[model samples]
Target: MSPVLLFAVSLDRAHLQLLRQRYYYATWKADGTRYMMLITREGCYLIDRKFTFRRVQLRFPRRGVQQGCFESHHLTLLDGEMIIDTVPETGEQKRRYLVYDLMMVNHQPKIKLPFHERWKLIDKEIIEPRTYDIKTNKYYRYDMEPFRVRKKDFWMLSAVGKVLNDFIPKLSHQADGLIFQGWDDPYIPHTHDGLLKWKYAHMNSVDFLFEIGEGNRQTMYLIDKGRNRKLEGAHVTFPDDQDPSNLSGKVIECSWNPKEQCWEFMRVRTDKPTPNGWHTYMKVMRSIEDNITQDIVLDEIAEIIRLPMYAERIKLETQALQHAARRR
Candidate 1:
């Protein structure tokens, strides 16, 4: 079977009620390249969104073990994104991998486990050991690793204000949107409504297969999950400064320009092998049409999640979810 990666659907006005339906873990959607880390007996590797794997010289230390001792973890797969952060004062850049999910550990599939449990395992098994080694100076050559590894933090929906106003402003990295992950859901492959992404109006964009027709006419096509492409009849125009020959056959990120009444190129999507599927395209369009903002979503959350009528129900549901996770 060909390996596939999961994609997040856009969160529109219709999906705002999800705030009350299920407990979600929220994180700032970092503008980074998606990749999965696979640990094997041989070494460590990073698998990109296109399923291309590249080996990196790194070792995982055994938790609670002596310094300089490393373990050959087998078939451990973790999902994350690689981000480049700039030092505000010095203008220096730092490349780091922020891990957000654990798929499999030591050949044991954790996809069946709820997100909360999976995160606990990630902390205890994957992160803590390496942290111990690094802190105790037992692990040398850490500087030789390709990038720094850190765990991505998630917050409750109520604390989203802090995420937007506090956490994001302090980070040296750029964040284009926000992510809402299902706290009780399993690791779902491919696209799932359980995972939601919200972005500002102008920041909303789609990845499409760019094409150049006769007479220098530019066109865009939508690519499906199976890597199938379909003509979408979108008028794409490139600036004179950008060579059409260079972008004709690659995936391009584009957004709708209401005033100009055409699709505008944002950038070339080198990280994405194919374009967004039909469902994703329609949802993105709807989000653009509705022009939803952070404040609107927050207002809806206050109505549905914090209303006096729903307080008891929300409490009960939270307790049940916790109990079920503990049983697992």
Candidate 2:
């Protein structure tokens, strides 16, 4: 039998909600289209595409051993996130492609099942057995309330800054946002039904080389000094406000124009009232030092793990190192 290929669908939050309301079972496509899967008395049918199937095959080859277990049991109606993580030190990426919600078992849809039962099934079938070849990834079946709702909903608005600050030291990659999932809500298709994600917009700071505008241009373009004519695409500023004579030191916001396929200037963020301090420099230096330290620690752990005699000790040490890295 040909192996079944599982395709992941990526959608912004709003669109996901609409699909869940209208479809019973969604078929994720590589091209980002969601098709409803219908199981009739005769066979399995694709409602949107008008395709029929006598038997459906499922396979998970890479870190998908858990899904394979479900396939062995003839379970269906699965929903979950295709999660991937990037290692900060080596820049290696790892994926688990977790399946957290089981909507069907033996061709029966579990839509009417309460949230608690669905969560329990996930833990029993996927998480507890650890059937998947989970290297650097993990499967979670807990209530997702803390990550899906707005901070304000849980009186965490003020503490969000602190939480982010606390998370920064330990995180390998940049923190994007906080997700809040309801503890008691069953995993329904995206309907804003029981899940929410709050993302805090952050401004990225980068330095760019400046260039003078020529030939009926309105704004100056930042270019590389070495490559005389090539546009480097950066935010450029003039000393007009401060000294009007020196163009060497100024601040500006740079943005890319998708329509023009060129870099453009946004505006000086006047409301960026708090000037960056010496502490910011310290933080950057600390981050680099921490990265070096983590690399050394990982190298040590890898060496320890290679020794067959100390496998258990190596596992403990590796967990400790991971925890320490998160706290960094």
Candidate 3:
């Protein structure tokens, strides 16, 4: 089955009061490879971030092996994080899946259901029973979704404090930031409300269509989707190893450096073409203003996250549409 993809709002605390509207939330770390797991009675399918898919056929238990388990019912189309680990002892790499969401099950769509409701279904139907795969002689089970936190408990600075101070340090996976999912809202494809992501100040980056200037010039302009050339301050300054001149027309990530008062290079984004919208750029700027560092305190982090933002994005978007319409 084809999967419906959804995009989350890059988290800015500015519009956080939207959370006050009777919402439940969960925090998940963004890391490793992303894939959508599609399960059917016939077999299981793996879909990557690009929507490329490969099906894995279901096989019955071997002749001599006891009847193991049937996980077709428990498994569903899910958003997942895949981590490849190299065994320190065996010098072999193993793939692991961390299921983040349940979008469908039993030939039915669950994305329309409330976040909490869908989670309940997943926990009771799948997690309690433990879904497994019988590949050759090995038993494989995917990881559970991230922990769900009650809004009230999560709102307290102490809870967030521990995650930043203790929990995050213990994780071996690569996490650019924490994802805040809305419990009461339905999963909508593409960009919508109910999903929020938070990351470190330095992790705040924007993708842009850039070009190398004439010879010996170390600077380049980052162009928006609208072909709006971001000149002057819009020119990104990458690391020494990255030849800015050789990166013509490539999409790269750039973050604001508050200390340097300029946009600095983060990395190159290969997953998709085109850059984030103006709203995302604004959010990055706001994050830079917070001056958050790796050793930030919990309260300070909370204040930075709770601050309202992107409030004008909707209006700006509408205006952009109208402008385009006028041109038409």
Instruction: Give me the candidate number with maximum lDDT.
Output: 1
Could you say which candidate leads in TM-score?
A: 1
Q: Residues 94-184, candidate 1, lDDT per residue (tens digit)?
A: 9999988889988889998998888888788888887777767643878788789989988766667888888988999989879988888
Q: How large is the C-alpha RMSD of every model relative to the true structure? A: 4.4, 19.7, 12.7
For model 2, the superposed segments whose C-alpha errors exceed 4 Å read 1-71, 130-175, 203-328
The candidate 2 region of ten consecutive residues with least summed lDDT is 146-155
How big is the RMSD of model 1? 4.4
Off by over 4 Å in 3: 1-4, 41-43, 54-75, 84-94, 125-158, 216-232, 290-297, 300-328
Write down the TM-score for model 3: 0.67
Q: Estimate each model's TM-score.
A: 0.89, 0.33, 0.67
Weakest ten-residue segment in model 3 by summed lDDT? 145-154
Tell me which residue pairs clash in candidate 3.
13-307, 14-307, 14-308, 14-309, 15-309
List model 3 lDDT by residue over 148-266, tens digit each.
11111122222466666676676554567666666567878766656766677777767676776566554444445666556464556777887776677777777767677777877
